[model samples]
Target: MFQKILIANRGEIALRVLRACKELGIQTVVVHSTADADAMHVRLADESVCIGPPPSRDSYLNIHQIVAACEITGADAVHPGYGFLSENAKFADILAAHNITFIGPSGDHIRIMGDKIEAKRTAKRLGIPVVPGSDGAVTEEKEAKRIASEIGYPVIIKASAGGGGRGMKVAHTEADLEVALQTARSEAGAAFGDDAVYIEKYLQKPRHIEVQVFGDGFGRGVHFGERDCSLQRRHQKVWEEANSPALNAEERSRIGSICATAIADLGYSGAGTIEFLYENGEFYFIEMNTRLQVEHPVTEAITGIDLVHEQIRVASGGGLSVKQEDIKFNGHAIECRINAEDPRTFTPSPGTITHFHTPGGLGIRVDSGVYSGYRIPPYYDSLIGKLIVHGRNRVECMMRLRRALDEFVVDGIKTTLPLFRDLVGNADIANGDYDIHWLEKYLAKEE
Candidate 1:
């Protein structure tokens, strides 16, 4: 086991990792930007270092500074709590070269899965179902048009190295393909510094379901069911739930087993999510997140597994603690990503939190890194917390979620709490009748 681990990110996830490390008797070092001088994670961490200024490029994303922090603290491992350098293959390699362990998959695995195009090829080779689209990246306009036409119009152009809805454009017909391709390529080049793009047959209405899989890097793996993240806005998931209301028991088991088997074969280590688009009794592979997902709490809530604890264990060369059969699904769980933003306009709301309150009681958990009088720095993501609720069933879960949302309060700044309150009361959300496009349309109508 590592004597000390450096948390390489900030906000709620850093706090989450810190608590897990404490449980395992591991000392922690948290590095923060100047903007986060008073951040909760820094305040609670065993040791803290100021990396740089507010800008992410100068602070959180600075590899040299992070390495220096590790060297200075004598930390043995780094647990990048998603975002920033979490998926950076070069970062992993650098850590290994310095005799520091990265608490995730190997650098080679991160490189292979980080690229969207290669991930699709790998998924298909592993017998995972994929959407019908181009065999590889289409460089020329002619080739792009040919693939789009062959895929039967309504194709989506995506960056080979992109995520979070960036560098993605959808074309409903051939006439729209040209503009979409150019725009997508331009956005791709600007965001990822790679103009390479691929095409996929766009689904009209598909549920965003992802299977959570963990491996021990030694030919052993297990799955903890799936999470339905269909409620999204601008390709960002707003609400997520475990045991997708859309899937039956058989379908869930089939997908879970497939993902687990594939990870076991690949000898992947730590936590990863195989995301898919589900439509009409079919699952199509989209991408795989090589790091812990933002919505991982819902899966943990259902499986009763401390994922962070497991991540640390596996990264330390310990085999998986639980076998496949040892895993058992409990009830329904839902997570609401409470961002510091305007619920209606979707604008960033970064300011001092005057009054803060979190809901309590059974089946309710709030993972946050802020308190009253904490200043939400504008340089980072606006997500202030996650509100998770679990119950014996979906109906009860929704009821509890509604009550929890009502009790969650953060003053002196706007938040998406109002949006969640509206969603919980909606008939479509209540009955679980929603898809990837549901939230966008709902927001449009409300506007």
Candidate 2:
């Protein structure tokens, strides 16, 4: 076991990791930017290091500073809690070169899964279902047209190295393909410094479902279950729940087993998520997140697994503590991303939190890092916290969430609480009759 672990991130996730380390009796060193000197994670860490100034490029994303902090703190391992450099293959390699364990997958795995094109190919090679589209990057216009035609009209062009809905465009017909292709390439080049783009058959209405997988670096792995993250805005997940309202027990077992078997065969280590688009009872692989996901709490809520603790254990060569059959899925869980933003406009809200009060009760959990006087830094993400709830069934879970939302309060700044309150009351959301495009359409209808 590692005596001390350095957290190379910020906000609620940093605090989330810190709490996990504390539970395992591991001392923690939290690295923060100047803008987060007073952040909750820093305040609660056993030791804290100021990495650099506010800008992410100079601070949270600085490799040298993070390595230096580890050296200074004598930490033997580093846990990057999603975002920033969590999925960066070079970062993982650097840590390995320094003989410091990275509490995640190996660099090779990260490199392979980080690339969207390579990930799809890998998924197909592993017998995982994939969408019909181009074999690789569609560089030439002629080739793009050929693939789009073969896949039929209504295709989506996506950046090879893109995320957050950037560098993506849809063409409903052959006439729209040229503009869509050119626009996607331009956006890809500007956003990722890579002009590479790929094409896929765009599903009209698909639910975003992802399987949570964990491996021990050996020929053993298990899946906690799946999270239905169809409630999204601009490709950002707004609400997520476990054992998707769309899937049944048999369907869940089939997909979960497939993911677990693949990870076991690949000898993947630590935490990872295999994301897919589900429509008409079929799942098509979209991408793979080689690090912990933002919506992991819902999985944890149902499985009763301490994923962070497992990550540290596997990284330390302890292997998995539970076998595949030993893991149990108990109940339904839901997570609402509580961002500090305008409820209706979705604009960023960063400022002092005058009064902060979190809901508390059975089956309700709020993971946040802010206090009443905490000044949310404008330089970082606007996510202030997450509210996760669990219940014996989906209906009970929804009811509990509604009651909890009514009790959640944060003053002196705008929040998306109102949005969630409204969503909970909506018929579509209540019945779980939504898809990837449902939220966008609902928002448009409201306008």
Per-residue lDDT of candidate 1, residues 253-305 (tens digit): 99999999999999899999999999999999999999999999999899999
> Model 1 off-target regions past 4 Å?
none
Query: Could you tell me every candidate's TM-score relative to the true structure?
Result: 0.99, 0.99
lDDT of each: 0.95, 0.94
Error of 2 at 438 (Å): 0.7
The CA root-mean-square deviation of candidate 2, after full C-alpha superposition on the true structure, stands at 0.7
lDDT of candidate 2 over 278-364, digit per residue (tens): 999999999989999989999889989989888999999999889989889988999999999998788899999999999999999
